[model samples]
Target: MFLAFFLIGLCIFYFYSIKKFVFFSQKSIKHDPPVPIFGNHVQVAFGRRTQTEVFNSLYKRYPSEKIVGYYKGTKPEFLVRDPEIIKHVLNTNFSEFCNRGVRRDPKVEPLMLNMFSEDGSVWKLLRHNLSPAFSGSKLKSMFPIIVSCTNKLVTVAKELALEGKEFDACILCARFTIDLVGASGFGIDMNTINNEQSLFLKLRELMFIKSNWQMFLYGIHDLFPESFIKKIHISRPQVRLIIKQILDSVRSQRTNDTNPRNDFINLLLELGKVGKISGESLETDANGKYKEMEMDFNDDHIIAQLFIFFMAGFETSSTTMSYAMHKLAFHPEIQQEVQREIDKSLAKHNNKLCYESVSEMVLLELIVKECLRLFPPAGYTSRISSNDCVLPDVNVEIKKGTKIIIPIQGIQLDPVYFENPEQFNPKRFLHETLQPRHKYAYIPFGEGPRKCIGARLGTLETMAGLAAVLNKFDIKTSPSSTRNIHPNRAAYLIQFIDGGLPLRLTLREKSSVISNGFP
Candidate 1:
């Protein structure tokens, strides 16, 4: 009887697969052929090539397909390749596609309920309450923190020069960003730059490394939604302990009431107070707003927000800065032009760099934008239909459970939107004709209301570190580094493919000094 039932189930599944493919008209949308069960992601799902390389290869193969349907096991997903459709997914019909295909069941993984894991009303509340933290005024206030970190970075670079050895600026940058995030996000003075073996540095490695099976899990999670599989539990005893220590410090500082200042933690504390009162007195809105007026931040919410910010801020900015340096090493002309611009801007401020002065560096900003185009920190953004909805410029109907992928890597490197897409040309961004190419063509930080909340802080942190390095040293590709390095996809997040990239740096004694490494 069991054998008979198994065979019957197999027949049903095989027919269902055929019927589903026919009903969806999968071939009409996809230029590349989807495998019997694997779909277009055979290389990625099976771990043959890196994620970036796999997607890049597919993108090159079918450059003109506006949409492609592929399977993650038996689950069907669409990779939207058209610029206008991507724009709609990102902006116009955003409500229909607000939630990403990710879930961190708070009951199971308490930390998952944080900003990155949530959607709908929860996301709305977290995002709304936190938006002010990164406003122009807030970032302006936070500029001094960045400058402090950058000064440390410059000091480190100089010390390395004195040692007369290659400094892994990539690792150094990570340490600097970690310190900046620790100070601003959690109110911890984790001077990771000076003490390479600081608790913060170790925690960062523990939090972000890609081990054998651990590496495979990133792809598995992305390919197969967690609801369908058993949850992979990660125990960060050290991280949890560290956060408790940090919170204890915060609570102790609050008790003193002697040195209360404006920082992210303080802001969250104020919101928590407001949220608590609002939870009682005011009648709540449909979206969980209080109709009666009492406000206080949930204790967990504060921790979650801080957790996401620290994780997102430090690593994303560090990887991006490193990749930009890699791009510069290959394209020295662009690097020189940016260096000249940085010098010109600094000279205006008497060769002293400040937040306002950094803001005014147009070419510097363009270079950053161009680098982001090629090596987006978070390469792709995924969304699920919040509700069944039709999007503009497409005939295909999106159902409630259907998954949508915005191919950032594919679109950013597509020639149709960006002429000579592979070339690292900052001027492409400055050209007037290319100005209106596609709204979604350059969405490294993303677009519209749901864009990266930490964008301003990320940009400031990245610029500060890059400016500091440029001020003290000349950066070049190491002979050990790949000629044109590519990212490893299994270790997704912040665009790093390999364990890390290493650069060789030489001290800049005079403005016009040249070295063997210089192109």
Candidate 2:
């Protein structure tokens, strides 16, 4: 009786997993064969490949197909490779495809419910409340904090240059950005620059290295819907502990702060006092008019927002800065040309690294944009239909819960949109030299209303870091450094370098005061 029951269970398991994965074939879409439970993501789920690698492979595999179908376990997902189709998914009919495939419950996985991951009414309310914090005026107000943090970066880099030994550029930049985010976002002095063994730095590093359960959780995160996967926890215990501690520390410090600066912490404090996040809803009534919605803004919600802010800033900006530096180290002539631009801008602004001066660095802007094109931190963008709708360009019908992927890395690297896409050329972005392509083809910070909220601040931070380093130091390849960087296969979400970026730096004999700051 026992043997018979075991055999029956085995058959049922196989039947449920394999039989339900026929949506692609029934729709007559192109896709590779999937395994029983792992589906098409067996490699990523088991930690053998990076997500970007999988995206690029699938994208290049079917060049002719505008939309390709694949299975994430028993669930069917589509990869929209065509720019026209991508635009529809991202903007044209955004209301129908607004969820980023997230259905995690806030009570169970609260930290994951930030603006980046929340869906529908919750996302709408958070976006409304947080929009003002990233405004041009607010970023300008946060400029001094950013500048002070960059000075710490410069000082640390000066020490590393003087040491005359190769250093892990990834860790160095990560420290700088962490400090910047802490100061600018929360109005606190993180000062991780001086202490290499800081727990905050360690926590940041450990966050990306997924545990066994986390790997399984994220692997199937989009594969199954909320109905099947209820009460799932989002982060590791240590990650939660550290983030909570940071929040507690901030709250305690602010109690004594007579004058809280214009920052995220103050914004959060105000939200706490209000006791709710109310705004015009992203969802409209049948009449197409938006309704007002109020969100339950508890302490967990605040932590989730702050968690994403720190994680996003710490990983993305550092990767860009390190990659840009690595590229400059290889192409010194281009580095010199960019340095000239930085010098010119600083001189015009009376040798000060202010908002006005940073804006004037056009070449610097081009370089950062090109870097984003080549190495978008998000790798790929995915969304699920909020309701069934036919895509405008392709006219293909996707169901209410069907997933759509915009492979950002793959599209940016396509030779059709960019010439010699692998070759790093900043001039390709120059308006006079840029070839006309679909605007949706290059979305490093993504496009449309649901795009990256902190893109401007992140870009300015990247530009400032690169300018400061180049102004004061000469960098070159180190003996330990790899000529080309490969994304770490083990990374959870962010595209981390396979090995930390290592480079040798030397202080420039002729450096300007603006290398650190204007004063």
Model 1's alpha-carbon lDDT is: 0.71
RMSD of 1: 4.6
Per-residue lDDT for 34-64 in model 2, tens only? 9987689788877788878887899999998
lDDT on C-alpha atoms for all candidate structures: 0.71, 0.83
Model 2 spans > 4 angstroms off: 1-4, 220-229, 432-434, 515-519
List clash counts for every candidate, in order: 24, 1
Count backbone overlaps in model 1. 24
Candidate 2 least-lDDT 10 residues: 222-231
Winning candidate number (lDDT): 2
- Model 1, which residues run further than 4 Å from truth? 1-27, 31-38, 50-52, 215-238, 273-297, 433-435, 511-519
State the number of backbone clashes in model 2: 1
lDDT, candidate 1, 1-519, per-residue tens: 999999999888777655555433643666355565455566776666665565566566766677776666556777788878988887888778877767655554566667677876566667766777888898888887777777777778777766766556568778989989887877777889899788888877666655566656555665455544346654344555676568768877787687777788888777766664222222356998554432345766666677677789888888778777777777778777778777777777766667777898787777788878888877788888877777566688778988887778878998888888888888888784746787787788878767999887788778867866775577777766665666655453446646567667777665522221111
